[model samples]
Target: MKRKINSFSRKITNNPNLPAAHAMLYATGMRESDFCKAQIGIVSNWYEGNPCNMHLDILGKKIKLSVINQKNLIGFQFTTIGVSDGITMGTPGMRFSLPSRELIADSIETVVEAHHYDGVIAIPGCDKNMPGVMISLLRLNRPSIIVYGGSISSGFYNEKKLDIVSSFEALGEKNTCKISEEEYKNIIKNSCPGPGSCGGMYTANTMASALEAMGMSLPYSSSSPSTSENKKKECKIVSTFIQKLLERKVKPKDIVTKTSIENGVKLAMCLGGSTNLILHFLAIAKSANVHFTLKDFQKISNQVPLIGNLKPSGIFLMEDIHKIGGTPVIIKYLLNQGILSGDCLTVTGETLHENMKKIPNINFNQKIIYPLNNPIKKNGHIRILYGNLSPEGSVAKITGKEGIFFRGEANVFDSEEDANKAILNHKIQTGEVIVIRYVGPIGGPGMPEMLKPTSYIMGSGLGKNVALITDGRFSGGSHGFVVGHITPEAQSGGLIAFVRNGDFIKIDAENNLLTLEVEEEEIQKRKKEWIPPLLKVKKGYLYKYIKTVSPASEGCVTDQF
Candidate 1:
């Protein structure tokens, strides 16, 4: 039964004074009984420039051939770097899409700590390759798993259901002529009909159903699909559960705690998901060192309730919740309504209450996941707002289908291509509140993601009589009455940089408030004639990510300010 060699692959493979690291891992071939096996570092954030990580190099060669057919394991595969925030959403290459989630977690923690790999599988498809490979498997507290390269099937057209946010709302329904140009070129050629990721519940199926309800992938590996055979047999059952998680050395900080990051924010606030899941779950609860904040997502969005109707804010997708019984039947309906925390742990080393006692029951006559006593929103739609234009707080996806009181009238625009060219040139109006403001994260040093100005304010029907505030961030195919991670961010000065154009903004989202109604001596005389705006990339890696990022209320993270 011989299975015990991994102490970082026994100090770089069967020592004997590491003969030049076993002739450089046999010059990329390896054998000598693969130095008595245990290596394992698959990684794969593959490319082809995007169909959300074009079939993740065929699920990284079927999870490196099921982690080298199990027993004592060996696998190596590598590759990282993915950025298509749906192909650089309103370009400058969408400021390298949130700095390619810190360059895919510093190129997978510098190739699993310079090739000492003794556990890590990751795979990941788009939208910051699932929290940049779960923050490089919580900063290499290894024996990791995460398979999720699924989701992509839904494209049709005449039969309707197309995706890639239906070609970013068909370029705002072809610049407001409301479709034609052969129906915006057949909704961008039947809206992404191949590979996967971005088939709603966006932000790559909302960080793959919040890392499979924070056990970090497995259990209907976040609702399958990328041309399913159950997402290639859940990548060979997460490569035979990463050899029982490296023979029980179960890591990733023993399955990401703080109650599984509040069971991944209570399954991304019961699947209404994305305000970029409050900036990729606060950069994966600060790389799972976990002291999570942004008010621990409004205290688990005041007790999770939205209940997955899906899409840019409902009407089903992640392949109709993988035909109504996936995501382990919505984590066994949020663990029989005690709203998740089924004893956490997972990578199939069980407990999420022993994987919800072999999941199954949620058919409740299918309407695509509702049944928490008739919910679509009785609570969590991811709000976290705070007043005085976000005094260190903000993030609103709001899903009570938008009307939680918005007061409007600001219209400003420091850029998301000038508020997507003033909402596709109709000059954004209807009780206005647009205000894109110096694109946060050290002011657009790389914040970028306003999903084409909130899909041109919902293809110009102005989604619910207009509203959009931002310090930059959105595109879980963005929905309206929007708001995004604002903080002391108009390049750190906050008060949304003393907002100005007709100032009157008062979003209350049922009293989580974001008010800006001016007059603290006219906001200190427009913050004494505000000025700070110049360094738009004075050099690379976004001028060292605008000299160290943070402040999207502290999760626009670049090593925490």
Candidate 2:
């Protein structure tokens, strides 16, 4: 093969004075001629710690082998850390989850930069891993590609499909005596039968689809199941594309432009994606130096229709959508409606329009992805709201079924644990808005997901009756009239800390408002007496995170804080 591209490897390989560098390469089994080839770093977030990433070691090896087969390229595989959000949620362990995103991104960046690899192939399987890897790629500004580890195949129980959320919700059912203890055990046992991210339109699947829409991953990459033969087939094709990317000097920043970011947001809106996207996208935008904001998200949310009939808010699972077709089918629908920008460039070294030209039109016969004209919801379910409560902003995922407007009295708790206990104990009532405070980035010191508490609300049959507002966030599987990512969090001395029980709170998704019905003078008095609580962690990563992490509005990115 003829070489036509410059490589970062040349910095180390071509320097005769760097005998140690050459020695290291030789020690790793590199041949004389191999030194001249482009060095590609295949970064893997593989660990046996969770099902989401358990099989990634096998996938990473396959990717390395594929890269080895590509002439004029030498593949070097490296590992990064990945925290399992599902395993950590609701525990003190959960504080490490959001901070893990930074760790993953920083670790990958450190390895790739230190090694001087010319390009990268990031394989991220979980929520933070996807954005974490993407952020590093954008920061590195190298020829790169992403291959999602893919969604898990849904587990079956009692002739019904189940995923991780099913297990979580089962805990609530057991507490409420909605199901027998044996039945709850059965759901837990079968909820996750094998490897892959959670099989819903949760954060993992949502980020994957959003990345694909933004032209990072290949079409259908987001929707493939982890154990599928198709996923392996897709892995084999990435090495060839990475070579093309390197040859053309196509970097992530070139592909992840403002229009492309908007494309991603538009797709997320239609998919009814996790509220986490707002946090992740803001971080990605900062890394890419794109001028995107939550306001930008609200702009797209206003126009895009919620067409995907999948997941926590809908009747189908990701596997169901995969059966009909994958993310491409959904993209095809959006493209037809002119909601997506076709002119954007993708990792395939072709314009999105060019790529979509090859994708078959949306299969209207499928129920998993609805047509735009007859969407599940007419407007996007991601509502970005601003009011006295969230002076900066807050995010609310409201499927119309939850009702567009909710007005209730305050039910305040300083931590998710307290609120969760209250819900399980049946202390939370109808016509109440549960305010979970001091759990934001600075307060929780890691901004844990409120999945446990939210799932309890649903299991306790109060999903629609009582709304939960928080400074933390919700899992993609979490539904109900819940609002989170409240800015100026309690730790930051936001009015949320001053919220008292019996205070009136109103959430209006239709108008995009989050209002705390307290007089300004009274709120001022409360603020004067309020003292921020001590952080849960005082040392290690959580301590550093609390000191440096930005607010939720800025994606809680630590670098710029």
Best candidate according to TM-score: 2
Candidate 1: worst-modelled 10 consecutive residues by lDDT: 1-10
lDDT of 2 at 494: 91
TM-score of 1: 0.37
Give the worst 10-residue stretch by lDDT in candidate 2: 1-10
List the pairs of residues colliding in candidate 1. 439-444
lDDT of each: 0.82, 0.90
Q: lDDT tens digits, residues 421-458, model 1?
A: 77888888798888887887777868888788787778
Could you estimate the TM-score for every candidate? 0.37, 0.99
Q: Report the Cα lDDT for candidate 1.
A: 0.82
Steric clashes per prediction: 1, 0
Cα lDDT, model 2, residue 438:
90
Residue-by-residue lDDT tens digits, candidate 2, 1-561: 565554688989999999998999999999998988899999889999999999988989999999989887889998899989999988889888899999999999999999999999999998999999999999999999999998988889999999899999999999988999999999999999999999989999999999999999987899888989889998999998999998888999999999999999899889889999999999999999999999999999889889887778887888887888778877876887899989999999998888877777767786777788888899889999999999999999988989999999999998888998899899998999999999999998799987898889888888879999999998888999999999899988998899999999999998899999999999999998987787788789889888888899999998993
